[model samples]
Every structure is written in C-alpha cells, then in structure tokens.
Target: MKTFQTVRGKLSGQILLWVLLAMSTTVYGQQSPITISGTITESGSGMPVAGASVFIENTSFGAVSDFDGNYSLNAQLENKDYTLIASYLGFTTQRITISITGDDLEKDIVLAEDLLSLDEVVVTGTGTGANRRSLGNAVASVKSKDLTNNGATQVDQAIAGKVSGALVQQNSGDPAGGISIRLRGASTISGSSDPLYIVDGIIISNSSNELIDLGGNSQNRLADLNPNDIDKIEIIKGAAAAAIYGSRASNGVVQIFTKKGKSGEPKFTFMTNVRLNELRKKIDYNTVPLAWEVATDRNNLATVEVERYDLQDAIFDTGFGLENYFSVNGGNEKTSYFLSASHLDNEGIVQNTDFKRYGFKANLTQKAFDWLDITGGFNYVRSISNDVPNGGINSAYGAITGFLFSDNSIDPTPDESGVYPVTSPLVARTNPMEAVDRFDFNQKTNRVITSIA
Candidate 1:
C-alpha cells in the first residue's frame, strides 16, 4: 500500500512541473504590441503637416498628428502584412505597404499637393461633397474675384448682369433700394419671386419685407452681407437638383460661401474704395416760356410770362462714397481662422439720402477627429439709411412723385422761417423740397447669422 501511494504522488508532481514549464514558454513567446511612428510632411516644401490622419488601412487603429507633425499608432495583430495610410486636406492621400514582424516601425510620409482639388469641389445648395462635373443639374458659379472686383456695395449688386438665365432688377433708384431676382421666372404671382438664399450652410431670410413703408423700395436682407467677404456664389437653377433639400429649393437656390483661412502664416489685407456718382443726363425740359404759356392758354388771351427754374441742382448732387475693409486670416493644419471687419458710407444723388453699414465676420475650422471636422461661422451686420421713397406705386409722399407732378413755375426755395411753401396743387399737398429735407425717412437694420456644422 505504501508503494502505490508513492507512485501516485510522483505522477502528480511530474504533471504539475510540465504544466508550469508550458505556461512559462507560452508567456515568453508572445510579442509586444506593434507601434508605428512617423512624421507627415508636404512634398517639395517639406513643411510638417499637423492634424494629418495616420492609420492602418481597414483597421480602427489610428492617430492624428500633433502640432509637431509627429504621430504614433499601436496595434496588436496576428497578420504580419498591412497597409498604412496618411492623409491631409489639400494634399493627395498616400498609402504604402507596411510589414510589422514583431518590431516597432518608423516610416515618414510625404504627400503631394492636390492641384485638382479646387476645381473639382462644388458648392451646391444642398451641401459640398460631390465633384462639379458629376452633377447633372446646371449650376452657375461666381468666384470671389468676379463678385468683389465689380465695385458693388451690396451683395445683390455684385451679381447683377453676371449670372446667366437670371434677371436681377433693382426695385427703384433709391441708394438702399431692394433687389429682385427671378430664377425660373416668378414662382408665385402674389408671393415673392426671389430665390431661396443659403449662406454658409444656413438658410437665411432674403425677405423683401418692408419694415417701413418706403413705397416698396425698402432694402432687402441680402444687402446686409458684405460683398468682399463672399468667397463663392453657386446657383442651382434647375428643379432636378432637389435630391437633398426638398420643396424649399423649388424657386431655385442661391448658395453663398464666405471666405475661409488657408493653411499658412497669418495674412492681413486692407482695402479702401472711393466712388462718385452723378446724373447721367438731364431730361429735356420745356424752356420756351412763350410756347408753354401760349400753348396752354386756350382763350388766346395775353397772360403772365412763365418763369423757368432750374431745380435740378437743388434736387440732385454728386454722391460720394468711402469704404474701408480689413481682414486677417491664418492657420496651421490643425485649425484655421478668418476674421474681417468693414465699414461703408455711401451717399446718394438725392439730398439727405445715404446708406451706412458696419459688418463683421468670423469663420473657424477645426479637425476634431480622424473622421470628423467642425466648422463654425458668425456674421454680424448693422445698416442705417436715410431713405427716400421712389417706386412705381407713386405714393403721395414719394420724393420722385412729388417732383414729377410739381409745376416748374413756382420756386421751391424755403422762406425765412425755414418752412417751404407749397408749389403746386397737383402733388397731393406734399412739397418735394420739404420731403427731401425734413421727411425723416430713416431705416435701420441689425442682423446676425451664425452656423455650426
């Protein structure tokens, strides 16, 4: 019985020793996690590209480069062969075969510039993703150079006579007059004919809603935008382009993209503009007093000679405009920022009529994750105008209407008390000179547009 127990204990001890040896061998044979480190740089320039995405292809293991353009990624894999990818904006993506055989790897990647990136990207009303050549709808694009180089004070004026298959018409000769654009003709007979306007991915109000009764010559909301801040304008003029935004794009869509910072050192820009406006020509007034009085007198009776008065100088003057704009833009690969401020004071040909505007805009873009990017925009504008009524409705108090119906025989010079006498009974008891001087037609608008996407 003693020999049997001893044999069983020896067997148990041998089995335990073998198990311990196998466990130790297994633990020692395992390899460490594979780490891939690299620096991403631009081709030719050799500038370090921060915020670059570096990862193994078809795998979740990835890392974004730090500000120094250095990145490190770790992965535990059973396979020895894999593909590595490095990508950044405005540069061509690079992929190379990498073999990780139980050792850490160091590989530097250089990406070439993507020359076709600017031409291929399209800003549709829905969003910006697809290439321009891939779209089936007819889209008209106006770049910043075309829009801002026209000396236009208003955004609507910048695109005037520039877009194809669209009619841009000013509502009146008033300096702050509203603009009407008809894309695909009038959408509704009673409603607005203006197309929907989208700025920086936010649908904004381009309403011609008359805040005050300026005889339908009230400024449109599009005037609030600074023309110099516009980067691009895209118009989807076809109805078939509604695959993304549904019925809201019925009247066609106008997408406005503001300027953004480029990947480089900080750049500052300052612009000043001076403009002068004068009457093109005067109307042929009846200067012959004998012809006017003799032709009007039906009884062939001798009447008092009619005096001719040149009131054109009193009603019109050379308008002067001064504008100043300043902008600063800068960024690294990880983030980019743009800021701009502008002020404009534009006088009108009509006395006591002018438009003044103050504008500020800021845009920012940040790479939050390998697959995610965040962009934000803020725009603020305040406009003040000393407006004068001038439209086809012919309001009784309209400055132009009063001038039209007034008799030239009576002088419009103000009296000693600074009160103007009524010149004619035809103008609905409203004096043109008084309306131009003391009508107190003032309109002010403050608007702020913000977006995050």
Candidate 2:
C-alpha cells in the first residue's frame, strides 16, 4: 500500500507540471496580432513613395512599402502604446504613437525631401571637416543606403563598381576569399599597392591570410567586416588626396564610420536576403570521339572506344546563399545606444566550398557632464570557410587536371555510393569530384574590435 501511494504521487506530480505549462501557453497565445495598414506618399508631389522602411519602435515588426507606396505590418498586441516610424533614403523620418485596441488600424504618411543632403557633412583627410559643397578636394562618400542596396555579403564587395576610379577584383570565386582593391593605378612598384583602411580612427589590416593545403587562396581581412554595421565610408582614391595620412597612405586611404545611436525612441530593424549563383558559361567540349582514341579493358585487355564524360558540368552546380541581420538604435536626452547582430551563409559554385560568418556590435554614448562626453563601442566577428584548392598541373591533387588529363571517354559521374572511382590510366591526379569532397581545407577566425573615449 505504501509503494502504490508513492508511485501514484509521482505520476500526479508529472501530470500537474504538464497542465501548468499548457495553461501558460494558452494565456500567451491569446494575445492577438494587430495589423497596421498605411500608404506612403511624397509631400510636395503627392506621389507614391515606394521602398520606404516602416517599423514599430523597439520591436521586430516591420514592412517595406510596396511599389504602389502601400504597406501593411502585423504587430503583436503586447504593448499598450506603440511608436511607429517611417523612413526613406532621401526624406525625413516620421514617427507616430498609438494604442492597439481591438483590431486593424489605418495610417497614411507623407515625407518631404531633405535638402540637407546637398550640404552633407563630410570628414576630410585633414583633421578639419566641411560640407560637400565647400570642400575643394575630390572625395567619394558611400552611405548606408548604397551598401545595403545590393545586399553585399562582404563590405568590400559593396564598394566594388560603386566607387569611381576603384578597380576591385575578388581573388577567387570562393565566397570568403581575398579581394584586390586598386585605387587609380599602382603608385609604386615595390610598396604595397593596397590602400590603408581606417575604421573609427583606428587602422585595420587587409592583408591576405592564406594557410597550408589552400595553396594561393587567401582571405582579405576587410571581407570580415559586416556591411550592415557601417554608416558611411570616405575614400581618398589618389596618393595626393591622402596626404594627411602620411606615407602609410601611399596606396590611398579608406575611412569607415560605424553606425551610432540617434536621440529618439528605441527602434528595431530586421533584414533577410537570399541569392542564387548559377554557372552561366560552360567550357565547350568536342562531343565526337577522337580518331585512334582507345582504351584497353582491364579484365580482357581488349581495346574499346573511349566514353566521353562532361566533367565540367559535373564539377560545377548552382549555389545558394542566405543572410540575416537585426539591429536596435535608440537613446534618451543624455544616453544613447546601438546594438546589431548579423549572420551570413554563402555556398560556393564549386563543390565542397562554403563561407559562413557571424558579427555583433554595440555602441554606447553618454553625456556625463556639459564638457565631459564619453563614448564606447564593442564589435565581434567569427568567420568559417572551406579553402578549396584551385586547378594546376603542378599540384598532385589539382582539381582542374582531373578534367584535362582524363580522356572524354572516361565517365566521372559519382556512383550510388557517392564515390567517384578513378578508372582511367592517363589521369595522374585524383578524381576532381573526389578530391574536392575529400580534401579538408578550412579557415576560421574570431575577431573583436572595441573602443572607449
């Protein structure tokens, strides 16, 4: 009787725990989602303003204005009063406060052009700053809008083609590989041709860091920077333009400004993107068999015509990539804060090649006293990639040689067991498909940038 009573008590306790969990879930789910519908238009023209950013304060609920300047956002009815903000690239930001009640809400916003863009403040090579109109020097400033417009996975990629006189080329097709940025032309034959990169008044290295097995593959450190965290960039393309930075700026100078908190209610933003990479051009191969091209059967020693294999197509395939970012910027009269985090996963067109990165940043500023202002920031990034080897005749495992050396008759397709059998006698290198899948070339790095002033 005592044992039975103990067992019954344990069973009853487990049942009670489940019942409480279900009850809490029911109560939480009871909160209905509120829908906010609105149309955005230009103030002067009364025309639709599409692609405007609309969001609720301090929450992940947001939507973009459609082509017709119409937008609708669903917000959870957790807060009694919510602040909604609408922003556009060339217009002033608009904010409205409201309380969520029973159901749907309607709001229409009008934005006026910001003339201040003409006289935008610009930081120069010298310690002094001036507006764009006053400055006589030739300087290129890239802002947040330009960076995010193309959805660049790497910060350097965003500047490519966008900056005039800049010749930016990625070293390899590998997503995480190095980038070659040449300003104007090479200034010196011996010195480093790469420009000097400065972020938040500190110099950052952009040298290639290649390891073993990867051969010539290298990753430029600048590729590690998260594009979303940047607010603006100033590029001094020529050596003369970077005179203030001294000799180290021989290659030119690139100054990066990180995003800072603005004085307003807390605001939240989330962005996601997906991209596909396809092989547009393939090497044309001779489909017909070459005369006198014959191979002997291993078992019978009988000569047989070679079978053609489209190794190029088998080696290349469609690639996909994904990116996600979240940020919150807000502050009060004296204190301000900006926090952001992002993740990227890029799959390369070549098999077994991939790049992944994670980034986080936090900036805080406080006006402790009238003359004593303080600022601090923390940044972190983690990168991972498979450094696949390139094709070359010198390398025993060169992937390219597997296609060139083998006769067209040899089949390179993988079998049911996912193995590429090396059946040809002429091929000295490992099967290209097998080599990429088997080789273990990986790159990983963790970096942190912090400041306090």
Candidate 3:
C-alpha cells in the first residue's frame, strides 16, 4: 500500500512539473520576435528606393526592400536597444536604434544621397587616384549618367560641344569620316595634331589609320570604343594637368575609363532607340523664267521646251537608324561581373550609303584579399561602312555639285537596261547620277581588345 501511494504521489508531482514547464515555454515563446515594417525613401524627394538592404545590427536577421520600398523584419530580443542599418549603392547608409517592447512597430526611414560623388578621382603619376582638390590645373570630368542623357554613339562624339576650349569636327558626313579633337589650339605646324588618348592607364592611339578606301575618308580608331561601355571621361586642357605625359601630350590629353562590376544581386537591363534624319531643304537654280535650248534639239526651237524637275527628290531618300543594347550585372562580396552586347544600323542621307556595327564587352573583378585585387576586361567589335563618290571640282564624277551644270530639259532617268541616260554619250560630262551607281567605296573590319590587372 505504501509503494502504491508513493507511485501516485510521484506521478502527481511529475504532472505538476510538466504543467509548469509548459506554461514557462508558452511565455518565453511570446516574449519577443516583434514585427517591424516600414518604407525606405530618399530624404528630400520622399521617393521609394528599392533594393536597399535593411538588416539588424550584429545579427543575420534582415530583409530587402521590395519594388515599392516596403520592408518587414521579425527580430527577437529583450526590452533593450537594438540598432537597425539600411544601405544602398551610391547613397549614404542610415542607422536607427530603438527599444523593443515585444510589440509590432512601424518606422519609416529617409536616406540622403552622398554628396562626395561629385568629386571624381583622377589617375596620378603613381598609378593611384588623386583627389580633385590636390590637382593644380583644372580638369573637366564627365560621368556615365551624362553620356546616357546625350546621344553619343561614338566615344569622340560623346564630348562634342560639351567640353570647353575644345574643337571636335567631323571631317565629312561619310560614316567613316574621322573626328578631330584639338585642345589649347594649334600645338604644332604639321605633325599629327591629335591629343594623346589614354584608356585605363594604358596609352592608346586615336589616329585615323586607313586600311581601305571609303571615298578616301579615314576612320578614327577611337570610334571602335562603344560609348555605352564607358564609365567616365576626363579632359586635361591645361598644361599642368598633362605635364606627367610629356611631349606626347603636347596637344593635351583625353582619358577614358570603362565601367566596372559592382557587388550586389543580379540586375538585367534592355534598351532600344530609333533615329530618323530628313533633309529639310536643298539648293537649286531657278528655271531662268525663259526657255533654254540644248544642243540636241536646237533646230526645232518651238517643239523643244524646258521642263522643270526636282533633282534632289530623285537622288536622296529618308534616312533612318536603329539601335539595341542589353546588359547583365551582378556579384557577391568576393567576385563581380558585367556583360553587355549592342548593335547599330545607320543610314545616310544619300541613297545606297549606310553603316552597321556590332559590339560585345565583358569585365570581371575579384577580391582575393584586403590588399590583393584582380580585374580583367575583354571587348570585340565589327563595323561596315559604304560610301559613294563625293567632294571636289570634277563635274562628271562629283556626287554633290556635279549636277549643277546639267540642262533642265535633260531627263536624268535610267532606261530599261538599268542604265542612266545622259544628254549625250559623246559629251565631256556624263550624268552625275550615273557616277553614283558606277563608283563603289565600302570597308569592313573586325577587331578585339583585352586587358588585365
């Protein structure tokens, strides 16, 4: 009887212990894990900023803002102070400390843009970035945002009219025509007047090296660089700013920096553009207000009369162009990568003249340690340019002004054999329109560039 009574007492004691433990567990479970929710916005604009990280200080608990900049996080802690940190690229990080009361809380945060972004770093003699404040001479810098706002298909064209004390002129309207940039006026009397070009700490030539004849128009090798891939441009107009480069930099200097990879989640972008160019007006001579005779029908004066015709309408066509670009970027704390591809198709104001280009670029960066870093870049491009006979004083072969002296009575149309009929086959000057089809000037090139550091 005593054993049975002891067993019952012990069982009752065990049940009481279990009940107390269950009660304690329930209270502990409800003690913390407070829900916090809010929106992250720009300080002055109050605009939501997506993709910003909202994390608890000294803990892994965090959340990323949604498309609308809304975020929610559940954190467990006692009634004590906890720090919350929010961070994003190109913006100042923000922190907030609050005491948790084991209840839901709503807090909105406003972050301001970092103002130091305006002062760009320049490459110095020691291969390191020098602060803008330390430079003795004035240096003009342009960033990617500015390039995007302006249409710069070619790198040289990117700075056209944007820089001070600089002259950027296209040799001709031909697609392959070169762009000449002269800073601080004439540096020399004869030898190449182009400024020295540097890309990523490496000296590159921007000469118009002509391998093929496209109406004798030389192409600037700088055009091979895709403006979409550039991150920044610095023009050293003052002599003090270019003293490090020496006599090669006598004309001045132009430094181009390519875009690099950033650490973050994978991001994708796609863009397209269409351009059209129409001739607003043309120059032509009036019909003289009286009948003009050609040698062919001078015998019959009454029957042979002048007929007015618009030559420009028959020679030129509407020019249109199309462009497409795609890019992908992403990275972790250790490694990052950027990839891009683009294509362009441009038509000239004159018929049968056009240009096309294709480009691809890739860049990668890896941080092996705090002091050791590695970077690599690769690029490939292909282009095609077609042109017709243009320029000069020749009346028979000139594309622009050769048609000036042709009589209005003569019809400059092709016959059934696809041949332009001239006023007279035996005359010194043939129809200028026939020269357009007979002459051909086209060029094609493919090149690759790579670098590592």
Ranking by lDDT: 1, 2, 3
How many backbone overlaps does candidate 2 show?
Answer: 4
Candidate 2 wrong stretches, greater than 4 Å: 1-121, 130-137, 188-191, 291-304, 392-396, 401-407, 413-430
lDDT of 2 by residue, 204-313 (tens): 88875565645446788887789889988888765465567878887778888889886577899999999897777888875765424234535555444555668776
What TM-score does model 2 achieve against the real structure? Answer: 0.67
- Models, CA RMSD each: 21.9, 15.1, 14.9
**What local distance difference test score does each model get?**
0.79, 0.78, 0.74
By lDDT, the best candidate is: 1
Prediction 3 TM-score vs. true:
0.67
Q: TM-scores across all candidates?
A: 0.71, 0.67, 0.67
* Native RMSD of candidate 3 (Å): 14.9
Q: Which is better, 1 or 3, measured by lDDT?
A: 1
Runs off by more than 4 Å, candidate 1: 1-121, 125-134, 241-244, 291-303, 391-394, 427-429
Ranking the candidates on TM-score from highest down gives 1, 3, 2
lDDT of 2 at 389: 72
Worst lDDT 10-window in candidate 2: 290-299
Residue 164 of model 3: what lDDT? 85
Candidate 3: Cα lDDT at 252: 81
Candidate with better lDDT, 2 vs 3: 2
